[model samples]
Target: MSEPRLSSLRWRVTVRRHPSAFLLAVQLLSLVLYPLFDEMRGGRVVFGAFGVLALALAVWVVNRSPAIKWIAWLLAVPAFGFSLLSVLFASESLLVLSSALEAAVYFYAAGSLIAYMMSDHRVTSDELFAAGATFTLLAWGFAYVFVVCQAWYPGSFTGALNPGQPRSWLELLSLSFTNLSAVGLGDVIPLGSTARVLVMLEQLAGVGYLAAVVSRLIGLTLLRHERR
Candidate 1:
């Protein structure tokens, strides 16, 4: 085999071995890139390309998971397609629809990760990575929910940076992180009844996720160490 073939083979092996890790890395990388892209002209095109890549990686990760893989692809294909269409046509309705679908895809992926983690007894490296990936997935899911809510109810969210104005994607994401983590540290505040209700649900989800998933992982790790 040639050098390019060897490199490609290695990459494929790594992805198969630890697909969740790659998904987690892309999610984390987006945290840095999203804001930078927002500052650039024609950044929506770049953002759309990156989102497609992420969704493709997500579909791959879901395929390796315990959950039904085809469902994720079903949701993801239209989600990213709407996203791409929104970018190209600059249609607000398409953007909202895409966000809603993206949220569903993220939440489904998160649930898939939870199933993957719980299906086995041994604490493997991939399961560990899935834990983090699941958290980010939930956060992204709720952020997109916020996006849709803001569209439905204008002035639903306000931030220190731009009071009374519509929140940006980054700001909504920040709010999602803070609410999901139960930190309440973000400057973005959800004011409308719909937004507040969503925040409350996310808060409960954060606590429940930590209590259920993280606790189980730690307990299993400890039990394994003790048995050794």
Candidate 2:
């Protein structure tokens, strides 16, 4: 094969061999790129490119294990829908909504895939950490954006705060994430039942998922060590 062909074929094989790694790289890129181009122009391009790459990778993954088709299809449906809306939508608010939804889906997909790998107990430590770290990066970005944009939020981000809260957009974004991560920063106080409950949900999901998956990985590693 020519060099270009070889590289393309190699990526295919690599993705098929290591779906976790492929997903990790894509998730990491999405996290970093999302905030930098919140405007959606540059984001659309990157998102489309990643989508194409993911589809290609998915082809290999599905061929090897059709079971992954379930996950791949679920992730792809929203990702593709958001991408389409982001490109075709007439209103900026619609686009923003799509982008935000895409972030949630991406985070969930990354988390679920990592969870799957952890349960496999066959993935290498390097691959596991790399995937976990990528997922963490997305979580960090999501939380950071929530904090940075706190001031501009018109209502309770997670139904916890009021529209009149005196916050800058950045502050709200940061606080949203801080609450999401369950950091208990103690600065953004929830004034209503919705805010308090929302805080707990975000915190619980953020910490619980990571902790559960990380523990599973540790167990796998320990099991392997015992075997050796």
Candidate 3:
């Protein structure tokens, strides 16, 4: 094949065979990119576009799993549409709607990955990748939930730099990661009852995920080796 055709074929094969790796890569890359772009003027538009890309990749990852692809599409279509509309029109209501839908989609994707990893006795390379991808998905989903909470109840979170001021997306995301990882190092603190409740739930989820999913994978891997 020609060079162009070869490159296209490789790209397609990678997406087909290792979609979870791509999803995980994009999510991690965003952690670095988000902070850099956020300080610049007109950064919100770029942030919105980046969100749409991540959602699209999530849909792709979900489709590769044993998930019902249509369900992911159903949630993602409106999520990204509302996301773009909010960016274009600067509508607060649309942004809230989009964030909610996006959170739902991410949760669904994470569930699908869990199901995929637990479905069979044998562990595949994709399943291994899915494990990490699922964690990031949960973190992103919870971040979106924080976004909605902040919108509904202003001053939901406080940070060291701007106490009582509305938290930025990066700050919220950092909070989510710290909470979900049980790090307890985030500067953002939940002030409202609603936010505190959500944070507690995410902390439980983080512990349960490690106890359940991680343990199961390790046990299964040991069993597979014993059988071999």
User: Which digits, one per residue and each the tens of the lDDT, describe model 3 over residues 1-228?
Assistant: 899999999998887787788788887887778878877543543555465466566566546544566677778778878878886787889888888988888898798788878888787777788889889989989998999999999988999996968888888888999999998997899999999999999999999999999888889989989998
Q: lDDT of each model, Cα atoms only?
A: 0.83, 0.54, 0.82
- Candidate 1 residue lDDT tens string, 175-203: 89989998769799989999999999999
TM-score of each: 0.92, 0.61, 0.90
* Residue runs of model 1 more than 4 Å from their true location after superposition: 40-49, 59-67
Q: Looking at candidate 1, what is the lDDT of residue 167? A: 87
Candidate 2 lDDT, 1-228, residue by residue in tens: 699999999987776666666665765576566666666454543464364346435333523456655555665566556556656655445445544544554454455455556555574844574545444444543543343233234344433354455443334445655665566673556554555565566677677666876666777778888999
Winning model by TM-score: 1
lDDT ranking, best first:
1, 3, 2
Candidate 3: C-alpha lDDT: 0.82
Ranking by TM-score: 1, 3, 2
Backbone clashes in model 1, listed as residue pairs = none
How many residue pairs of model 2 clash at the backbone?
24
- Considering TM-score, which of the candidate structures 1 and 2 is the better prediction for this target? 1
Q: In model 2, which runs have C-alpha deviations exceeding 4 angstroms?
A: 39-75, 82-93, 96-104, 107-111, 125-153, 157-195
Provide the lowest-lDDT 10-residue window in model 3. 40-49
